[model samples]
Target: MKKLFQTSSLVSVLNVSDYTVALTWYSAWLSKPDETPMDGMAEWRIADNAWLQLDATAETVKPSAAIIGVNDLAACRTVLLEAGIAVGEIQDWEVVLSCDLHDLDGNKISLAQIISQQ
Candidate 1:
């Protein structure tokens, strides 16, 4: 049998009342202001090629699964903080520094940077 492929793509959706506003913010956050928007959904492409989407019909909930790892933890944290999205404080794991946050819909979003071999 063929071995399973490495990690594929990811798509995460969050609900927001102001889809346009959310789109603008996400465009800046992802550094892709020209990114397209479809109907009630706006998407951001994370570093790992994960799709982070915002939908108008979604309801607030704890995320079942959502996270984005970055090369510069401190810088990423700063960006989120500057955008007023950082939740609580930065956490230090055995091999990473991470922050757990939520979007307008309350879906969990994590930003982390590796500190050592995992």
Candidate 2:
């Protein structure tokens, strides 16, 4: 099949109801956003080619999910737990170790650490 659009960058957006609360919670979970392009929106540079964005809206939103690639899932989970966040049990999938959590708006966020089989 022929390509429809030229590639540039990828963005994953999690729409939320409360901007202020979501901003604070996400800051604790992912650190301060690298950029706040405009009001009611925040962005994090997940990788050279990808980004994660938080958008504030009053309309109904379906829960969205995102997986973050971390180098140490255990340490990441520990930090979040200490911050009083309800993080889920870590799952070991042979090639990956991961844990899950929800944002202020119930958006599912997963932290995954890839294990080298070498």
Candidate 3:
């Protein structure tokens, strides 16, 4: 039997009614205002080489969307907060400091900084 595959990439899908504002807000966090927009969505290259996709629609995804691991969780949270976004409390996830936040479209995302090897 074929073995289950490993997840090579994580994608955060944000469904927004106004794609323009959504893209603008995310672009600020990314500090890549010059980056070209993708199809009907904007793709952000998060730390660890993951992708963040902002979609324009009314679709609602489960709150358990994604929890991404970053190199510096505190710094990421600071950057996001400085950009006027709400940064949730950080939880001790054993080996990581995990924090949760939502996108403009309300898709939940968790940001975690690993503190030890799993």
Better of 1 and 2 by TM-score: 2
TM-scores of all models? 0.69, 0.86, 0.71
Q: Candidate 1 residues 27-63, lDDT tens each?
A: 6567653345767776777646677777775665333
Cα deviation at 82, candidate 2, in Å, is: 1.9
Higher-scoring candidate on lDDT, 2 or 3: 2
Which segments of model 3 are wrong by more than 4 Å? 1-10, 33-39, 47-49, 57-64
Misplaced by over 4 Å in model 2 are: 1-8
What is the Cα-based lDDT of residue 118 in candidate 1?
38
- Candidate 3 per-residue lDDT, tens place, 41-99, comes to 76777656567776664465433367777888888888888878887987897877998
- Model 3: how far is 37 from its true place, Å? 6.3
Q: Could you tell me which residue pairs clash in candidate 2?
A: none
- Per-residue error for 65 in candidate 2, Å, reads 0.4
lDDT of 2 by residue, 7-93 (tens): 998899999998899999888867999999989999999999889999995487777998889998899888989998889999999
Query: In terms of TM-score, which candidate is strongest?
Result: 2
Error of 2 at 21 (Å): 0.7
